[model samples]
Target: MSGHSKWHNIQAKKGKIDAKRGKIFTKLGKEIAVAVKTGGANPDGNSKLRDCIAKAKAANMPMDTITKAIKKGSGDMEGVTYEEIMYEGYGPAGVAMLVNVLTDNRNRSASDVRCLFDRNGGNLGANGCVSWMFQRKGQIVIQRQDGMDEDELMMKVLELGAEDFAAEEEVFVITTSQEDFSSVREALEKENFEFESAELTMIPDNTVSLSMEDAERVQKLVDKIEDNDDVQNVWHNAEFPEDFEE
Candidate 1:
């Protein structure tokens, strides 16, 4: 992962961001809607919906709000239809970026995203530009401790159908196929393996390195992309040390 990506993961640990609450809720709502529309509302039958609900709960979303969103998505209640979109781009230092969005108006969102990229030292690209650098995967991160053995954990998760496991500083990162995500997670839970995170994420196949100055610039581009109201998630191929400061 790039330094910018690591920064995003670090930011997630910094506590609630009330200033961005509205934006966050919008994104989360879209996720719920999509999950419901795609897989139905029952978490038991729809693992994707279940994961989305879990995330919304973690964000402290109201129960009624979640239910309403699901209803809208299922067409039991009327609401605007959301379209999922992806934008590919290159940032300063030639870092590849993939931005996932949920929008009711693609033209408006696209224009806004393109503008944000231009303003932040990056430029949006054609569909396949940066997408080839990434693959969708189920990712989970377990908090590290003094005595945890990477090899042991790797063996356990791999046996449960995980594709890869990496120990980075105090974090154990596990990757799995999209279809196997829920199964692998359930297996881990059955074994009582505690994880700090469990989510569907895009993993980069390769990373682009840059000087600190260029990396900071790239981070700014990422921030701009993320700050957009229509953006749901942003993935990038940039690598930096886990302990890199700033």
Candidate 2:
């Protein structure tokens, strides 16, 4: 699996969670709303919307709530306008981090993010600071133990334009360049290959190994940044110890 999947699995095993449920919903809701706004509400016609809906379903969000979010985005209902933002920085041990956000109040979000970094042993940097260390890609995590042969699966995805494939923690992860993401996903779907998760995310080029103390500090910054009302995603280069939870 890709590094993203490893972190996700780690989070799952930890069984603990995000800042506040309400705030978490806000971040997710904005994603759905934005997707609908950008590409009409029809999932069949909007791949991004489809992905957002899938995540909403995975989170156990109600259908009515999802519909309401779409309506808000389509201007059928009034709501705060959300602006997408990205902040890059270095955490403890010089771990590179990127935080994606959607917020109506840019000033408030910026200050809160800056303070979070400062308080957590990190320092926010200029726009291009840590961004060059990452690449945007589409990733899919498949449960490898469900009768799927690794070599066969690798060949199949490779034919669909996947750049690389690997196995980790009993899961097979497929990666594709951003341009080929939709095509690759569709190919897999046509083959009836089931994926545990599919997402377009930032993947670090290389990881930074850290002492436990520094790792915890970086994680603390990550949690704080992600907790902000505007933040949508947090990515970092810190490699968690195999046994680290959450």
Candidate 3:
């Protein structure tokens, strides 16, 4: 049991991002397109593309948009290339942070990210500086509902290759080794298990406890970083208050 629940952090993000629906969909489109570019157009054979599709759906993006995004990746956007980059850094109170970026203009993206970090009381770090503090894992969150059997679900998840399980106040968090993530997720989907969230994410090895002020500062930095079109995901290890808001 990792006993760590980033579900609240996710919820807090969702709460604030509702107003950015169009931008969110556009970013998801880029993600789907990139996934298709690298892993083929078929989600069944490409876990990364499948994951991108899932994220698009979760955001309520229309199916046609997803199909178009997939097509965009299938060579329609010739001469345009996208590169994935990982930026590492530290936030307020020494909290480690990682940013995942996908962009055609690497130089511009880097400059923009650095500026955001500088403005938010944070600074970019060397490649290996903070990345060593995180482990890539498959994380799935299933919202708690009446009649769900926790033990039974845990057993099933384990049988499907999950590495860890934690029951939080309103959700069950399931984690799997990087290699086992796709199989476990596919199995759950076959069994009709709906997920609140599912993705391959960098899980912090440990967290930094921050005062409320520092937490808010770190969160503000996170928001600013995420607002960038090139940034795909942001991972951090900072203990924060419940119900973080704008």
Candidate 4:
């Protein structure tokens, strides 16, 4: 499997825990709120909000909670207003890291993120330090089902403008240019396809392989950063050894 596919598979396994599920909902709520604030409340008119809603539903977030987040962002209800921020850093083995956060207090988030890196044998860097090593792409993941035809799926995705496709052990990963993400996703949805996850992501151009010990340290650092309520996504270029335990 590709490094990205392996990382995502590990994450999927970890997300089965109840505590992680709650954290996932909280993060999705923040995303919905921010999407509503940036692009109006109506999904038909706001592509970002529509995508957030779809993600929220996929995560099984309660309808009422989703509605409340929308209301909060649309000014119908009072709530914390979050600002998006990006933090760049390097983890163990010189692995480049990018953290995306939605924070009401930038200073607190920055301090927390930096401390995680420092304590985990990494260092936070100035803006643009590691970003140049990655490219923005739209990624969609669908769980592979019994008797699923890979050829058919590839053809379907290519016709819908997807840039690439990979059939991993448990899921099919599809990549698309950012501009074609929405249309491709809509087309797939119309065909009644269920997705494991779908979102715009930063993909590393190259990866840094790490020893088992260093890989563990980097994974811990990533977990700590992701557990922070303000953090939305954590991207990295660390490639664990093929035989490394999850």
Question: What's the number of clashes in each of the models?
Answer: 2, 1, 0, 0
Q: Candidate 4, residue 2: CA error in Å?
A: 7.8
lDDT of 4 at 97: 97
Local accuracy of candidate 1 as per-residue lDDT tens digits, 1-246:
212135345344323334576677777888988889888878899988977876665466788998888887788535667789999998888888999998889999999999988888888999998888788888776678777777888898888898877766667777888899888887877777666667787878877877778867976777778888888888888774444444
Best by lDDT: 3
Better-scoring candidate (TM-score), 1 or 2: 2
lDDT of 3 by residue, 73-119 (tens): 99897888989999999988899999999999999999999999998
Query: Where in model 3 is the C-alpha error above 4 Å?
Result: 243-246
- Kindly provide the TM-score of model 3 when superposed on the true structure, using C-alpha atoms: 0.95
- Cα RMSD (Å) per model? 3.5, 2.8, 1.5, 2.2
* lDDT agreement with native, every candidate: 0.76, 0.77, 0.86, 0.83
For model 2, name the residue pairs that clash.
Answer: 1-168
Q: What is the Å distance of residue 190 in model 3 from its true position?
A: 1.3
For candidate 1, the per-residue lDDT at 180 reads: 90
For model 4, residues 1-246, the per-residue Cα lDDT tens digits are 233456353343347424588878878877987888889899899999888887776666789999988987788535667789999999988999999999999999999999999998899999999999999988788888888899999999998999988877778888888889888888989988887777788888988878989988888888888888999889888888777664
Candidate 2 per-residue lDDT, tens place, 1-246, comes to 234446343344223233355565666788998888789888899988887875665454678988888888788635667788999999999999998988889999899999998988889999999999899998776666666788888888898899888777567778888888877877777777666666677888888877777767877777778767678888887887766555
| TM-score for each predicted model, relative to the true structure | 0.83, 0.87, 0.95, 0.91
Better of 2 and 3 by TM-score: 3
Better of 2 and 4 by lDDT: 4
